[model samples]
Target: MADQRVAIVTGGSGGIGRASAERLGADGFAVVVHYAGNRDRAVAAAGAVTGAGGRAVVAGGDVADETAMAAVFDLADSEFGGVDVLVHTAGIMPLAPVVDLDLDTFDRVQRTNVRGTFVVDQLAARRLRPGGAIVNFSTSVTRLQMPGYAAYAASKGAVESLTLILARELRGRDITVNAVAPGPTATPLFLDGKSQQLIDQIASANPLGRLGTPTDIAETVAFLAGPGRWVNGQVLYVNGGAA
Candidate 1:
């Protein structure tokens, strides 16, 4: 019956998305690794899942686009029966102080982060079978009040609100909606062109004394999507006591 467990992990081409896909596959869920533009990486991630004795498929779409998300869901239905879990990790974070942020940059971030969450959450709410779960991604910036992250923080704030509201709206559907807020994670996006000195400074700020790994956040997602159903409507902060 484990093969009956199908999951769709948005943005699964890299970072926490890829980690969650791998973990879900390891947990016996047939995963659909969804990517926006990185086809090769998405295929590789799916292949890794299959190589680990699990079933997986690669799907491509822009999470902020409703039509694209619908196509992805259709592919999942055609390829693997139905979606049992939806892990929405597709987002964009461009840090800039509000005073210095360009309107276009802010709009792009909102379009990808907030609009993307809305589009994917709508699909999951409508298409996910009973006993399914939806996991949304947030960031610790919302709680940390960090400078140069006004737009990014606002976007994640919307996700947190949406997750809680959707959980309430889905009252008796047997589906749990929740969000995970990760701290400074060492993804390619975060480490690119950053100095080791700055990275170390940021790492030292976390109570855990290090930057978070994608696997660290992915493990929490696996729990929420699997047996952690009782923890509904909660913004589970996996920030290693940083916030």
Candidate 2:
């Protein structure tokens, strides 16, 4: 295992995070599955990796908490040597019109989406070995401009800004920083509370005429993590032709 690359995948308990964990594991990275609250799911994510002949471990904490996240990174260092990839897929999306959204809800969204990205990316920047890659999550809704997604879009917009600027800042480190803005993926997070009509509309918006799967997004991330070294600082819209 001395020659294996290591990846710390936040939100490994759910959705794109789980897919990403398994994909990176299959790609030969010893994965550290980071979860905010669900320990069981996190364990399952790690188990899938090890069950398939890859090494994995589970770490738990809010991604926005610096001290807690530092411990999570320390676990990766202790268990797998050093971090070579960071897939920050942990985030929350609550839809409400900006004029009607509660301040508390807006603040909570910012804390998890914006602040979490900041804290985790900061740690990744400091700890990742040379040639490491950092992939953060953004959304196509930011482009779709769906009416109720104002707060969510604003938070993700911050993430996109962070991705671009950080890539420039890491100019000579041989590390690639990029964001994956997936469109209308068929995940619990995307399917929850949406009407069938809405889902169909979203699927139709993409030229592919179907929804993207976690694996679809995961493959894009896996490329960025491993062999897609020349692709840096850009947000790849994995939305099947959705703008």
Best by lDDT: 2
Cα-based lDDT for every prediction = 0.93, 0.95
lDDT of 2 by residue, 65-165 (tens): 99999999999989989899999999999988878999999999999999999999999999999999999999988898889999999999999999999
lDDT of 1 by residue, 39-138 (tens): 9999999999999999999989888989989999998899888999999998887877889999999999999999999999999999999999999999
Report the Cα RMSD per candidate.
1.1, 0.9
Model 1: weakest 10-residue lDDT segment is: 1-10
Predicted structure 2: lDDT: 0.95
Cα error, candidate 2, residue 16 (Å): 0.3
